[model samples]
Target chain A: MAEKDGDENKVAKQDQLPADKTQTVDSTSGTTQDASHEVQQELVPSDARELEVVDVREGAFGVRGTGDTSGYGGLTRPVMMPGAAQPPFGGWFDEVHDRLQTLTDSHDDRVIEKVVVDRGELTFFIRRHALLEVVTHLRNDDALRFEFCSSISGVHFPHESGRELHVVYHLLSMTHRRRIRLEVTCPDDDPHVPSVVSIYPTADWHERETWDFFGIQFDGHPALTRILMPDDWQGHPQRKDYPLGGIPVEYKGGTIPSPEHRRSYS
Target chain B: MTTVNDPYAGTTESTEGPVFTVTGQDWDSVDASVVEGDRIVVNMGPQHPSTHGVLRLVLEIDGETVRDARPGIGYLHTGIEKNMEFRTWTQGVTFCTRMDYVAPFSNEAAYVAAVEKLLEIEDQVPEKAKIIRVLMLELNRISSHLVCIATGGMEIGALTVMTCGFRDRELILDCFEMISGLRMNHAYFRPGGVAQDLPAGAIEKLHSTVRLLKERLPEYAALCNANPIFKGRLKGVGHLDLAGCLALGLSGPVLRATGYDWDLRRTQPYWGYETYDFDVVTWDEPDAYGRFRVRLEEMWQSLRIVEQATERLAVMEGEPVMVADKKIAWPAQLSVGADGQGNSAEHIRHIMGESMEALIHHFKIVTEGFRVPAGQAYAAIEAPRGEIGCHAVSDGGTRPYRVHFRDPSFVNLQGTSVMSEGGMLSDVIVAIASIDPVMGGVDR
Candidate 1:
């Protein structure tokens, strides 16, 4: 199940870090791989100063061609993401990174995939296989004791192609009085990431919540049942593909459309 | 040996004896299971009064001693996070404010602060606006704690404690209504600042309310602080040490009760909280009684912050509460009209006649809302319950890409099993009340 094909599933493992960190993976190459490939692409930064265009959305209100009576038919915008940060990340972020690196340096491949310092916060993107080890170190290490796992939030980006699901763990170190974010990604087809319940018992329900919403299965979760949704519910309601269910409201003369059917701006 | 055939009970005949398969029948009627072992499973509620807001506890008890306890939530799940994805950034506040109904200001503050951080306008948010936000949040803390004490006291059959708690809480609600124009679910805290400035006579009302609360606050101390029965019911019950709290990721009064002086307001100050003076109330005992004392004392600290804010608000009259940014700040300034509340006449005139550009901006802002740069930021605040954090992701659009709240109640609720297991079945209510998990937040 963990086997990978050449080039197609290269980004899936920690060993295949893009040599040119600024390279962008085309969506077609990542999407065409088989389910067994377990393709996962790390979000590579394109430029140091500019925003990396993740997707180029065309025609406002999701309309294309002559159907768009609204004059925004020709308009297009690039959905951008901030690039990875350079070394010497201001404040204690550098020390945490150095300590985490020192602990995981013996490994064949780097555990820290990419570091993103955005909006006065530090985010460390980690590989799926190394997530448990990294989290345990963060908790047990006296130097970096992120003792409290604040919450686990799952983000499903269908546009990310190979890596369609992302799990972010917000950790708070009360001992050091610092906070850092750890993010791990997995392919939508094989959404199996290691569960950190062994290290942090509080992640029990949070992992359940992430699974309930995004359907990202934690491989070793003792009882990974839906927490906030009914057990018999069909689809993960928070996924981008799932429809926002609502009924149309009827006024005296005309019926007002539901939210999904209403005119959209983006 | 019974003559009547019971259709409800699915019974089958075996060589040794007649086996009864329990299906939708009364659990007490299942004698075969009781014979196998002394332990019996009981479902407390998705509807019981003491469970507090649709939280169902599945308890496996052996002769009134709980062998195991598991919480069954999601009965109150409203999918507010999913709903916020479809709405504009400014409109997202309304959805999140309703998450923890008791402390709506904390929800709004965390969300709005996160949005401002994503916008990189955290510093640009007016000083007066931060003060008001802090003031409203402190007031909300008092109200939320009052409800916790009131409902917690009611669960233990203390009628007077419940009545007095609510009575004092009503005064705080009046202050909230006087300023935000609503008693609860006040979507007053916006992205740039608050929805509007403090209304006329709001200061006087706050002063009077604060004075009255100070007078009546001691009633709770006199009533429950030394009462032997209250002490008997709460002391040493739901005991979770500092290690247990750290492992389970508990915070607020629950963690503070363990004698840890960790508070987001003190440790990681936001919205100029470091400038204020207040103690992080804590207790050495890690139990229901300790949590109760922590909450009771935290209310006094919150009142101190509230009083300081009221003094600052009196002098900073006529200062702009919203940010100066034309692109981000809300376009309309509301006023009380002859009919009801409506857009200010000056703003209306400026948009209608003064400039066409202003008119376009007004239309654009009101209809589509302002856009935030693409990125994600997590803003955590010390809410009345615990650490309430908002993780907001934007795709450089008017609508949010994804928004998730790390509601303290939700995380703290995970400790129910750990706290209640191996204890008397009666103490389950005390354990839950001490954690104070708001189902609205837990199931959001």
Candidate 2:
């Protein structure tokens, strides 16, 4: 039986933008189209300068660079930042959200932040410290039995100051054939998050890997050593700030630029 | 042995001749002393001939029994995920294909599917492309499982099965080479569809390969099914029950062997797999033998799917293999010719000799990959080893913001310690063989 929680059980389905239309400028094409086009249709950009003026998203979005042989010169795509999804979460998403919200409210109040329903998948922005409690509840609650923690992946948002490192947990519910993502963030300088290995033992190696590539330390992981990078390697390679340069290979008449030297969309 | 000078032993003297403590007569005694007295730790290799590929295992052993087995990996870390961030979305396929090294098609399928989902173009991709994808995936499953069986057989000291498995696997690879012009790392699957349509005569070749596999698969069972030596080494060894599998996030045949019928192809049903008629094979023993049986039976199921796909493919000719939308698909059409494969001469002449717009369009799509709407999608396929997933995040950029793979080998390998901890030293190899951890997938 699901517990009765007053306001916590409310799945806040705010009126969201139409699910299909996202405002991403097609940098490849020179034209822009209004949202009236079919959901999948993309319009070419109108200006040729649009391909070179990528600096507009500087410091706010993905990397920007110059001098690339690849076609994208000035095009910049603006990614939507994570926010709360308006309610009537639709299909199984509303149920999963309410169950988690109620369960977390009864168990711990500091678990979730923003609930995003994008691409028909539900994502819970969880606080760094309450990961274990949240995961345990999600796995144990009969209605929300997300029995499998499918994977633990880390993403670094350089623009998101104070919370630059985000660790994502993709959980699967075999009983209901549902999937949910739990995202927790920590600052780049202090990237320490509580280990969810206690709830999902599968997170052991994955947590170690996150530590290896992104330098996010799992507070209670048994052995938080590097899994992919060598043990003595210094910097986490997957971080956005980490340079991509490698040993430059010599080809016939051309000096191939190392990734750091090559013009990338910084 | 001690009577000899032995100056080369007991020190780091690479400048001198290699260390040679063993004299002809002293070899047996040295082996005797280790087994009879002291506990010795064995380092299995960053290069062992059993063909797991660049994995090193340190087993602390007390005589013939292993006290503990610690895996030291990352010898094959290629920074593939990092490299993907630098390339356009389309080029990411080439890099991901090389990660698993074995199940190239599965990696491509998962990555492409994630990108398709992120771009919100899943429904728009041509139906012909989906059927071809299904065909390639099932065929890839057969080929990858064959390699697993081959290498697994060799690791367990069964030479005949290894030979038969590899020999049969070549039939599939040859078929792949004919279709995609490469056997192993076929970057055949692209974002919208495959890189190109199946080559001429590919259907007949695939049909022959399928028939040949049907005849050869049972020979493997006959050789190992009832053999006492084979069963003795595998049965009741490396026991990972359903609980162990679920706790560790293990999937594919390993979970199937534990009697959990959780194949993603059936449960989640990506790539129209739900429409296909096949049973999810499972076994209840939950041991090395169980995994072995599960893998064999799964191969049969893959073959069944492949046969069905080919039958449909035969009927569906002249259908577009790529998406209908011009922007999402690659610009140039490639054709196989007298010298291997390359861009079509006719398309090249058309762009160069006449149309300025066609040339510019080609330039833009080639240089900057198509932008995916900013969001994230986790697309998983039941790979030969287990659940291979691609978690793709696009920043509305031509390149991916981040791409992470839930490589099944990496997850299933957590069961290594659980399986080998209490077992005998020799069973360690059997356990590893059953888990079938591809080091490329593990270290990537």
Candidate 3:
């Protein structure tokens, strides 16, 4: 987990580079192939050439080391995270991105780490320190009035090393009838992200639920306690490392194995 | 008058005239401190019928006016989202359907939409499937609102409204049972398309359901629209204006009641909802009574959508309802048989005897499920309660990496304090009912 921190900084620094420079790095790396990748490269400016390879997965199923007895024993795939999108994001995305950039550029240039346009949805990877600033601007700004924060979902990626825990906020501009996602990441040891309850009051319970499930502490949240689970429960059950604990089932003739022990493809 | 030696005797003689000790009850054991100094802390539910499904409210009242109201939930948390991580993407519909049990199809539609979006097959989904989805979702909207109005009315001592509301809801459930086999938690909507085509005579049944609900819906308007007692109970109660609603992220009827035409079907327009002819109901009162009227009017609008969908389905007979994708779509063509619902006879014979590759394809798809590309997608649909959104993240695996639902019940419940405070204590029930939160969805 500690070693993952250096890898996180490397990726962050690479993303911080200029778009044209990153394209040169990608071309030299020679990982950009396939028809869809080529089309995407032509469509998006160099910054959104190809998604970042998060993990090089081995085997067809999730299980490793002979637990996977399926015929796809030698299959391997690269799990890619969407890379940053450049200008002319198409439709309202470019406008929102530009407006947000112009408004927040005075405070911190690195606030918006990456802008990803994947599957016709726009996502902004906001810095943890500037999450509140970007969110408030999105909600209150005249051109960018994302007045409604529809959801705040926390996702845990234990394999990602330092930035293992992520929080994704879905904001809907009811006035503009547009939707956008803002994501923030924190290391598991220091899983502290500033709370948005001050801006969007609806985030009160959502932040608590994120804390309860992934143990991502939303700093400055009022009375953050277990909302769904019992107060005495231990460990965040939704984390990737947490076990899906189940007991054997008793039947008329014999007992059956728990769900995790059962024959599963993934 | 009874002897002390007798086991059932109650009276005993004392130094004064006679001292009688009363047991088997705690009528006199009121803790003075709890209700002391004109500030009373009252705990309502975890079991009470009126709290709407195990919702516990801790309210502090100062002489009939509620000073603070805090809603305690999670009595029904089955960790549906967490459990979805272990199941296949197609099987996720079943788990989420049970979240808001009353509005199961809405949950399925929202979840399946997210899955389809993640798979990048949103357009490949059959046109007929989208229509049927719209049909079932509208029908479910009616049923869910019926339950809300029935239970909300019952909580406030309107027995006639409860009976009438449920009486009409049964007709909708009958339509669901005919089409989906099971009435609730049908898991009828698959990721690529629906689980099966409409059963025989499903169109006629749906048409009749719309016709029947159209006639029955007006009875509610007549019953409570102008009734003095009903108005006295709900009017001017739980007043939350448009600003408060926007701030709290309230949606559906609660937000609409604040006079905002913000229905997602009109604003976001998914599943061809833009083509449907209907009106977004709004009430400017911004109170419990306004929410009731909004729900009442929305039911009529849902009926209109259902009517339009049924008319369209009448002509769309014999059309394929599932996606044409061989790898992603479920192989089974379901048909009801003497034994039970299972694979159709022709489909079974084709896979079992006709083609060797077909059998292998069936086994692989059913056992392993198809893999979705590595990505994340969020899909939101306007459910009966509010905006139910599903955020699905896939790690290029068969199973979901993480699935989270922003249940409107859970989010709207946050307004319990803001809505009910500074109002009469009795209006707290009115406030919660107006929100129409299903605790199962709230805790999920």
Candidate 4:
């Protein structure tokens, strides 16, 4: 089991790199490709080229000698965590962003760190304190009316420092037929975000699930117990650092390494 | 006074009168006040067959009336969402399809839709592919509802209905096998389009099954709907009004049964569903019987959609099913060989002996898989149970960064406490059966 407390500064290292550098796929897949040595190529810069490769994890490929004969086994995949999007944010995204801005009066309203519009969906990376208020306004505002709390999902990014753990909320407006995502990050040390059960009772199990899998705690939840895994299980399985823990399987006088330890192109 | 399988006919069966420390029942820390006033606490199965796949209910009752109900879940957690992180984007479909074993197509659709949205190829997808997706999902809805009524009818002690329901469900499965080779868990819908076009005469096979289901629905209505015992058990047993449905995030039949027109297919139209003409079936009675009526009516609506899709697909033959872009698509060109469904022989020959570039293209796609740009998307669809949503995040790699399913079963499980609180213990089973939760979806 790793330390539940994640450092806040770890994720800041992502912004230091220049935004335009191209990332190589590398020989992530490691089997027969060793002889072929697939040449590195630059990804075509379309609308997606603007996103930066902020962080890369160690051991991008699986462990060696696990029978990973697929030449792509040495694949060390570098994750591209993109930077914040600029203004004029297109379509209904601009209206949602501008409307929420008027509702809040905080002088230091750095609630929205980045505005990312990708694949026709808008994601607001909000500060932890603004979650409850912003959600309440979204539900009550006649213009927004995001009455439905669709889902609350947990995502763990081990290499992205400080803001290592993310709790994502998918909110829907039945009246407007629009959906927006709200993501809040908490460091490993204080993985606590105020519970929104009072506002949206449906968030109860989702919060429990996020806690069960990512170990990010919701401070005021009624019952903060594990919902999916056994009550007394040890570590959060969904975290990237956690191993999948599968032994190689033997079949018909041949052996195949578990996906956990297989070599892949990185 | 009751000697009919009443093991405690002579002796009393109350907390104060006698103690029964059953191995499965556990309500140790309940309030002391409820312990008095002729109350009894019984723990009903993480393994009990009628509870619908490993769900355990802790019920506190006074005589036959339930005072409080607490649900204990997680017996069937396969950690499927976690396992998806290890596999490729296309392979994630296999794991996701297994989550809601009852409605595997809807599960597959939700996951793959998110992947397509991330790739930003949503609009460029071929028209015929969208039609096939609609065809498969509607067929899946019918089969899933059949299982629902079949098992629910059996749980309420109607053995004949169970036999009929499962028997009819097999026909739907037969059509499914014709399309994707597998009867259940068919990962038919790939990111860009379907894995391949419809097989020869597959539409005719679907037409026959659709005709059969349309005819047999009325027979089902007469046998189970009009039966007084069936009505007595389900009519007002698990009553949930519009308020309860809205607060609990309930959708599909349960919400529709409350006279709320909240079907996602009608309201949030996906995959050209808006182009089709169909009613969003609703019922005045929000109870177990109401859900049954809503399900039966929805089956007819599904039949209508399937009939329409089959007609469109007949004209759409020879059109492309996979995307024109080669980067996102798989290398295999699916075809029905003599033995079973497999890759095309012509395409195989071209790659092997005809062209070296074709062989290299095939190798690259097969080896690395496809890459999706860095972003996140949430896609939801109307499943048999309720609204099933998939939240997919890509790190611009061949594999998915993170994926989570907002299973309708998990959200609706909380309602067991609300509905069964003041109802009879027998009605508790009826109420749970009406919810029609698949534990595989709930725990995953």
Candidate 5:
């Protein structure tokens, strides 16, 4: 049956051939005839029904019947059933709560203050000094092998109390496909946190970027330097207090306004 | 030559010639052992090509080997995050698109999705708009990977491959130009819906181009993969295991190359990706070669998706690409003015003669954008390079309280040290290239 389909496909392709390729057409036709001859020798069942061949194009020498429609031309057909809906957020919240409880019981007391589960992810607020201990535990724990550090960013919250800046750590457990966030707060005067690069080497750049942008120093970092800005640049750019610069436009035909330019209402 | 008194040089007041007194009396006793050899400190960048865009690496070297590498960044800082805080919700799309110039569509999609979620308008977005966004993003992914392959080839001394890569990439860019007015920074994917429907002939052109790419991509694979020189340079170089990738928050091709089949499109399924039939290409090699194979295979998968999407688009013809909501989208056709700027005829007339209520609403929305309720949300999408996430905080304001982007290139670039530590200095180039860090994304 497959051999018969191949012969029909060859004939269909040969019908589309350009006029100059006569020799190639003859050779392809010969190959098809040879293939049919070989198939005739292998056939044994006399009771087999003859395979119907449909002439798709009359008088145009095109042979087209239902062949293997699973090849290149048949790829346009949608192949899979519709996917299931997204899992509810409540289950995700429960998992995060469970994980938080496990960490709180296992770790030192008075380190993790509260767990804020929002938008299907959990954020554990740890004291600045207890960050290293928590991260070490998270890394070494067999159940929570958060081997990846993903990102370390600092957010400045001048209006908040005990600490003005919140340093966030996004960690992932590749083994279980789970993610958790660890956040620690430090005062603006002394924005220092223990370096996690010693535990996960990937934190080197993330810490450096955090320091460069938010000015949150990561103590014990092997080589703390700016990873996005020049060393001589003044002020952390991402800090809320840092002033944004304006470029004076001179060659706009009509003067191009800077971002700070305000429109005058008539 | 005259002894010119340069005022700026050595002008600080001190006890004797700028604190030249020695504490240990080394000048009195001439000891050859006391004179230590000088160690040189050289600054590599802010301009060098290898440092990858305004990145300055301060190298402390003793002889040939580097003792320490201190990377300095922020030369390209444009304060985009802060600027987003000032802009209205719908206008934030333009600002986010500039964050990752290579894959602007992904940035736009992420920002739009976050806003849509905040507004609770996810279901309101038209299906045709979602399909259009998916098509644009997949095509953008192909172009972005082409750039990575081309630049990686150039960095590794295969100049011919760069030309081939860019030439193929141009075809995709041509399609982009036809759909979106601009080629690179297309703010075409707006909040609520796309800027407009797919232009005439775009679907047919995409169908043919995707078909051609499906046919021709194997040639690129055969050429680069079959070449022993290319393999020797790339294979086993810059190996970041799954542990390293997960630890560093690496996403996209880098994580997949380490054998993690975690694509947000497949796993999380945003923008109707759940309906698509495609595989997340992965490799267990965890090296530069593995990354290459993964990206190459992903391009093929993207083609498969584009083909399926184009076919689907053919059937869903004449559907509204924009949402019914007029608050977020302008209720007029945007056209290029004589000055080549976007202008709408209805917008001009509405401002002049519209009713007082309509004028006030337009004024407020145009000036302040839409308000997002006070809440915090984290939206993650699979960008061409990796996982691009936007963590937004809104305090019931017309603008975002805080918006942060988790750029994958920034996290992926950190693995460069792990890959290049004990290896030869030349391997650093190949390693960085294989990671395919975009400086715009990294710095942003």
Candidate 6:
């Protein structure tokens, strides 16, 4: 531990280099590229020319890369890959991706709705009814082995046409420092999703919280109790339709209703 | 009382029925009323001092042992998350800072980082601002850990340790007051940059305090760790193995205690944490004692980072802490009234008479705040407790579409039951305290 601290200290001290030494933008090119890479390659692709390797030391490298194609605006400087050789849990992301591909290939087109890749993390949007089967495949499939449910959070999209409530499940592979998000959406009136507590006992409270805030019921949860909000609290507090506050105090002859009391005409 | 099929039975026969019983019973008249066993329930707190806050635990006791313990939260809920929806983007900082009052800077930094991510303006944050943030956050981490150590000690019957912990923590709060102008919930960290630059003498004070803490920490460790009673009370109590912690999404020292080395600062760097040198302290014991030791060691590591960060701040003496982007950062040197409030008579007159464009722009920005492009982003930071993440969604509007905080205390608190389930009832207090949950952060 002390050795690690010492190495980090050395790196931090080296990082105190003058800002000018790290500056990449040149007046001539009007673009920033790795100064060290200029000698190794010639005529870099116009699109890829914006990639600037900010720092390169030891096994780690920081690159300021642009993502214009994915509609991801602005320059993103992801610390591409850490210095560690093995992904925290060996081959975590790779196994999940391969398993997901195999499952999607065998499943019906409607069962596997969409797959969106945001940066390195993958999100699979399956049909609400297929959530149980998909999650089961991910958990039980020897190759996939997404044994842990990192989080289960609910998102409300009021303006969306069909599915207004999105239940997002974050899965992590402890053996591999890999993560994937599983999203399933259902209409606001009937927000029911199959519970994963049967597979992972840790999902008990997370599912309860989702139920508490978004009013999404997880079938087969042992105790679907309110984890955060009061047991008798009215409505789903996180829903866009729910008002922010309900405290109302009338002073003198005038009356002032809290934010909750104000009617949502829409 | 009636006993059956036992050698040393109190009474073999009853007295109310047509049977012969003990000394007081008449022949042919005996009563047999067997006592049924039912579980006794005890409510531990919504106001109990030992509960740490308004936390209530309903325990089902079978004799002297606890059969089931259910935690009841939300007594301290203030609806801060819901309130964030009604405020402007910049105004949300004031609310987020209150969530983790012990380490307000972490909450502020996480919230602002999320906003900056949505705006895609993180890189544009000035160098000085990053250093200032690291400085404030490390100091906050130490202060927060001190509170945990103190309160945890108090919970474990170490009264003197509490005094030492609180006394050391006050020094950090004094530093906070100097920099942010408030002891707690300062709202010092804003979207584009810090609310203001570090005050004069803040670095000098931090240097002396860090040195003092480094010297004094060993005494604290000796006081708590070396004592036989303290060790006996904590050593093997409330053990949550590595698998249990990982399954429950535990982070910070609690997770580290279980032999997992996961620190967002090292794994996923932010706020120029990549430029700081520190260790992700860990222990394999995975017990209450292990957690206590990890937090104590973490304080020393935090002090090291503070020393180094303070040196870096000294180098960037007078650099602009706020971003140069006028669209994001408010202009410096705004004229103030005698009451020290902005929008004074002179300021408004100058803006209206001299720079009508500035007046119009200020009015528009102040009224609506800056609009973030429609997108979603999740930014995580290492708070004193664990991984504090902000998942923000924007719909190309001044108001955020959705803002959800993955508070570490909340996630870490989930592992409490896993830690205490099979342990003794007395172990429950140590287990809960080891997690060091601030209910404000959890229930936010």
Model 6, range A184-235, lDDT digits (tens) per residue? 7776667788888877676777788888888998888887878878655677
DockQ of the candidate models in sequence: 0.71, 0.46, 0.57, 0.51, 0.16, 0.14
If you assessed candidate 1 against the hidden native complex, which CAPRI class would it receive?
medium
True contacts kept of each: 0.87, 0.69, 0.79, 0.66, 0.42, 0.28
Candidate 6 Cα deviation (angstroms), residue B408 = 1.7
lDDT of 5 at B418: 70
Writing each residue's lDDT as its tens digit, candidate 5 over A2-114 gives 01222233345435444332112011122223323445533423322222111111211111244645343332111111111111235554554455457756443356655
Give the per-residue lDDT of model 1 (tens digit) for B164-186: 98998999999898788889988
Ranking by lDDT: 1, 3, 4, 2, 6, 5
- Candidate 6 backbone overlaps, count: 9
Model 3, span A147-197: residue lDDT tens:
999999799877565778899999999889999999998888888999999
Clashes of each: 0, 25, 0, 49, 10, 9
Error of 5 at B106 (Å): 2.2
lDDT of 3 by residue, B217-331 (tens): 8899999999999999999888889888888899889899989999999999999999999999999999999999998888888888888888898998899888899989899
Better of 2 and 5 by lDDT: 2
Deviation in Å, model 1, residue A105 alpha carbon:
1.4
RMSD of each: 6.7, 9.2, 9.0, 8.1, 24.8, 15.3
Candidate 5 segments exceeding 4 Å error = A1-89, A106-109, A117-121, A137-145, A247-266, B1-46, B49-72, B330-333, B336-341, B346-351, B354-356
Off by over 4 Å in 4: A1-11, A14-54, A57-78, B1-35
What lDDT does the true structure give each of the candidates? 0.86, 0.79, 0.84, 0.81, 0.69, 0.71
Q: TM-score for each prediction? A: 0.90, 0.85, 0.89, 0.87, 0.75, 0.77
lDDT of 3 at B121: 90
What is residue B324's positional error in candidate 3, in angstroms? 0.4
| Candidate ordering by TM-score (highest first) | 1, 3, 4, 2, 6, 5
Better structure of 3 and 4 per lDDT: 3
- Put down candidate 2 lDDT per residue, A129-204, tens digits, no spaces: 6678888889999999998888998999875545668899999888888888998878777888989888889999
User: Which residue ranges in model 3 land beyond 4 Å of their true spot?
Assistant: A1-48, A60-63, A66-75, A106-109, A250-256, A263-266, B1-36
User: Among these predicted structures, which one has the highest lDDT?
Assistant: 1
